[model samples]
Target: MLSRTADHLYWMSRYTERAENTARMLNVSYETSMLPQSASAATKAWQSVLSISELLPAYYQRHDEVTLEGVLHFMVRDETNSSSIYSCLQAARENARAVRGALTTEAWETQNLTWLDMNRLFKAKKFETDPAKFFEWVKYRSHLSRGVALGTMLQDDAFRFLRLGTFIERADNTARLLDVRFHAIKNDYHGTVPGKGQAQFDFYHWSAILRSVSAFEVYRKVYRNVITPERVAEMLILRRDMPRSLHASMYEVVQILEAVANDHSAETQRQAGLLLAELQYGRIDELLATGLHAYLVHFLERVHALGGRIGSDFLATADM
Candidate 1:
């Protein structure tokens, strides 16, 4: 495959996944913000979304304060915010258009139609009236796009690259979401004792975290008990059986890197393998003992470094 084609295919998949993940993060914040909380608490929840995406500076430059209305508009429909859902879907469509030949007819149509439908929604100001419903639409469209690609596209390097992009984005988002939510939950209980109210508080926040990743039911089935922070972290960060878990994403990353290996991709493969090993053998107890926030920060740094390696090894032309 041409380097440019590969780049487009890879980024098309990433941007689509990014749109869905952004919706997921925002949805969690939206849901929690509806609950009874202090004004400062609510503001911090909204701010965490920006922090997770590394967009705080951009957000502050545009807005004087972190109001719910301002943050929602900035995240959902702001075209200038590159990480906004609008920009991500736009980028996804542009990349898909550039490599229509590499995509199946169904996949290309799905990508194009998603963009068109999103524009219509924006024109109708759908996000302003019902942001949750707007987010659900974005997630469903992303699901449809991935399903069509997997079902219609050939299982070749192009497909591998697409899958690769999806998992890489998933892994990073999962880690960020978990880290921020867990920290908030911890802070909420800083001076509280273990009691029924604390249990209820933990349940509400932890379940919100699970639902953000679409793993609430999975948590119920896998653990078959009350939701606890340790178990929640374990399920999201270590459990290989859970589809959106870090371990599972890394497993896919390792396998896909091996499948699409090139002469220059050895270092990329090795780094991916090392990351996978850390997840595969890692225990949640140890992670929480040391500090989940610190652990996740390190993991994000490694994921960023691995992304840089992938670009240098195979997607260098993306910069051009």
Candidate 2:
């Protein structure tokens, strides 16, 4: 494949995955804010959404404060925010267009139709009136796009690159979600134990966090108990069986990297392997003992660096 073609295919999938995950994150904040809480707590929930996206400073540059309406507009439609769902879908469409010959017809149409529908929603101001429905639409479209690609595309390097982009983006998003959600739960827990005053209050928040990643039911099945912070963290961070968990994402990433290995990708493969191994053997108790935030920050840095390495090796483009 041409370097430029590979880059477009890779980013096309990344942006689509990003659009879906952004919807997931925003849905969490939107739902959690409706729960009974102080005005400040509601504001903080919105702030956490921006923080997880690492767009907090960019957000403040365009707005005075983090209001629900402001965040919805900024994250859902702002063209200037390149990571917004609008921008992500737009970019995904453009990239898919650039490499249409490399994509199956269903894949291309899925990307194109998603962009068209999103524009209609923007014109109708659906996000303003019904953000949750709009978010579900985005997630549904993303699922369709992925399913189309997996079902129709040949299992070639193009497919491998596509999977690579999805898992890398997913791994990064899951880590960020875990870190931000963990801190929010910690603040609400206030060193309180389960079955106490704050327990019920914390339950809703914890449930929101799991639902953000679509892991709530998986948590129920795996633990078959009340949602505790420790177990939630364990399931999301370590459980390879949970589809959205860090370990599961990394598992896919490592396998994809090995499948698509090249002469230049050895270092990238080594780094990816090391990260996957850490998640593979890592324990929740040890992660908490050292500080989850610190560990996650380090993981983010390494993942970002790994992304750069993958770019240099395969895409021949800078990490976007």
TM agreement with the true structure for every prediction: 0.96, 0.97
Number of the predicted model whose lDDT against the real structure is largest: 2
Note each model's CA RMSD in angstroms.
1.5, 1.5
Q: Write the per-residue lDDT of candidate 1 for residues 1-320, one digit (tens) a residue.
A: 77788889889999999999999888877888898877977888888888888888999999999988998889888999999999999999999999999999999999999999999998998888898999999999999999999899999999988998899899999989888777766775544746777677778888988999999999999889999888999999999999999999999999998998889989889989998998889888888888899999999888888877877777835332
Cα lDDT tens digits, model 2, 1-320, are 67788899999999999999999988888888887878877888888899899999999999998899999889989999999999999999999999999998889999999999999888998888899999999999999998999999999989988988998899899999988878876775466554665777778888988998898888888899998889988998898999988899889989988998888888888998999999999999999999999999999999999989889988859778
Q: How many pairs in model 2 have backbone atoms within 3 A of each other, for residues 3 or more apart or on separate chains, i.e. clashes?
A: 0
Q: What TM value does model 1 have? A: 0.96
Off by over 4 Å in 1: 192-194, 317-320
- Residue pairs of candidate 1 with colliding backbone atoms: none
